[model samples]
Target: MEQKTVTYEVQQNVATISLNRPAVKNAINSDMHRELYSAFVQANEDSDVRVIVLTGSGDAFSSGADLKSVATEKLGDIDYGDYLKETYNKLLLYMDTIQKPTVAYINGIAVGAGLSLALACDFRIAEYDAKMGISFLKIGLVPDAGASYYLPRLVGVGKALEMSLGEPISAEEAYRIGLVHKIGQPEEFVQQLLTLPTTAYGLMKNVMASSYEHTLAEVLQMEEEAQTTAGKTKEHTMAVQRFLTK
Candidate 1:
């Protein structure tokens, strides 16, 4: 499918899918959402693709929802929850569980749902100058698009609540509080994603996400299961052989 809001390309087994509406900081609308999902599907299905990197076109990663579009909408008894069910909910779930490791390359400002999208990623690599915000309460809305779920787990409930209720934070503060795993150039991170034993990464990613809800015995069983699966991969066999030789 032709894409206008997102740009997709594959090189060195990496599928880099970028949000392309730099004019407005890549603010998402329905078209962008649909195109973003399609790009993700393409990357996930391609045999040559092992890593997915999501970034923005220009300086800003994303500015969240297109408020102008919302402003233009015929406001009435419009069901916001239903709107999420149709758009962000599905995208977030798919992204959250996309088997392969996904990185949100935060280039600049990310607020509201844009921040939520980053939270959906397995890892977040941010530029030093990037700024992040929840910005929901500022508009009298609460967090959506998986922010509520990922934030508390990411930075703990105290920091999450503070950030959500207060001002936007700098990239340094984000990293200090565990909002981002790394704050540096994203190129090295992308290269590592492309070259790493990502099959094992995918397996571990799923198990890790599921471990949160599973009991210790159940988690042990899952570890056994995931280990068995990972042990069978060609990458694992090669890695073990490489280790033995060294």
Candidate 2:
């Protein structure tokens, strides 16, 4: 794809959609939002891509919305809610429905909406030196880009509230609280995800996300339906065959 703010590349079944604004630490702007949505579409449509990775080109994943652009605009004229409705709402919703696993490679600072973007991913692998937090409070803004929904789910309501009122935490702290899957190379997790059954992963993602909001009986029904779908896949059939033969 011919993109400006985001770069798209696929390697070893992993489609890497990198935020390309390294000069400003990959801070997202309107252009970046458009490009990112397109890149994700491209990745989702590609048959070669088993996993999708969101990362940054420089030392940071993203610094969040481009405050420089905001500074230049008339504050009274800006409708923040409209901006989100037009921009990331669709992108984040589409990401939730992605059949492939997604990983956020937090190489450095991921604050504000940038942190929210990372939270949208199924797995987050933060570099050891990365700093992350719900940093919207510093700028007198509430968390957007699905941060408000995802943050509390990962770290519990109490910790999420504390982080909202405080500074960015270290990658180690993030890992300790279940914010990130690990603190190391993103490739390690991506490679492992690629080796898993893609169909099962997608099914599990749907069921697990539903598990949080549904009753036990509802979730059990969801698992029953998902398992029926999974059991029909060639991968599952092959595994069953191999097991019986052994």
Candidate 3:
């Protein structure tokens, strides 16, 4: 089956969903939004897929929305809120709801909604020289696609605001600010991330995502529940047996 705009592949328990529009720096259009959501859903539903990685085909991860597709006449008539509601909002929500761990392997420049896409992932690992930022203000738009929500959570409110208003930062700087988990050569980066235990990682992602909106008591309860579910997994059982033998 031909996958348009995005490519989905599974190898060694990792499902990689790549944005395929290299000519425009993998800019997301309506079609890409649909394809990406489908890719995530596929990975989430596949029991063999342990992790999902999102990246772009070319030098840039993504440059955000395709401006060429936007018509001047339609700009005035466009319902911006409705546009997001139908497209990116749905994709972001679906991504957030996936129980599996998600990683944004930011290979290069990521700006505007592209940054938001990376922020939504449970972890971000970038090429050492990659540039990343929320650049919606440069085009007279506010950050959409969950940037406003995830940015502050990742980098703190003050730093998130500053970065949103400023130019893109290098991957090294992004790591220093905790925007990215790591920066390294592509091969090493992916290898390191894939070493994580998938079932445990997913549960931890759930705990962290919930912690932001939940009270301490509620978060502890959530952790206990998630741990109970995770403890019953085959992986967990095998790991314990291995530890006992060792």
lDDT per model vs. reference: 0.89, 0.91, 0.87
Q: Could you tally the backbone clashes for each prediction?
A: 0, 0, 0
Per residue, candidate 2 scores C-alpha lDDT tens digits across 1-246 of: 798999999888889999999999999998999999999999998999999999998899999899887755588788899989988898999899898999999999998889999999999999999999788878788888998899999999999999998488999999999999999997777878988889998999999998888999999999999999999999999888988999
Q: What would the per-residue lDDT of candidate 1 be over residues 1-246, giving only the tens digit for each residue?
A: 698999999998889999999999999998999999999999999989988999999999999988777744566656789989989998987887688778899999999999999999888989999999999899778999999999999999988899888488999999998888899877787778777787788778877888889899998898899899989999999998999999
| Candidate 3 stretches greater than 4 Å from native | 192-197
Candidate 1 residue spans exceeding 4 A from truth: 71-73
- Residue pairs with clashing backbones, model 2: none
What's the C-alpha lDDT at position 128 in model 2?
Answer: 99
Runs with alpha carbons beyond 4 Å of true place in candidate 2: 71-73
Q: Which of candidates 1 and 2 reaches a greater lDDT?
A: 2
Pairs of residues clashing in candidate 3? none
lDDT for predicted candidate 2 compared with the true structure: 0.91
lDDT (Cα, tens digit) per residue for candidate 3, span 136-207: 888788989999999988889999889878599999899999999888654555666676667777788779
Indicate the worst ten consecutive residues by lDDT in candidate 3: 184-193
Q: Identify the candidate with maximal lDDT.
A: 2
Better of 2 and 3 by TM-score: 2
Best by TM-score: 2
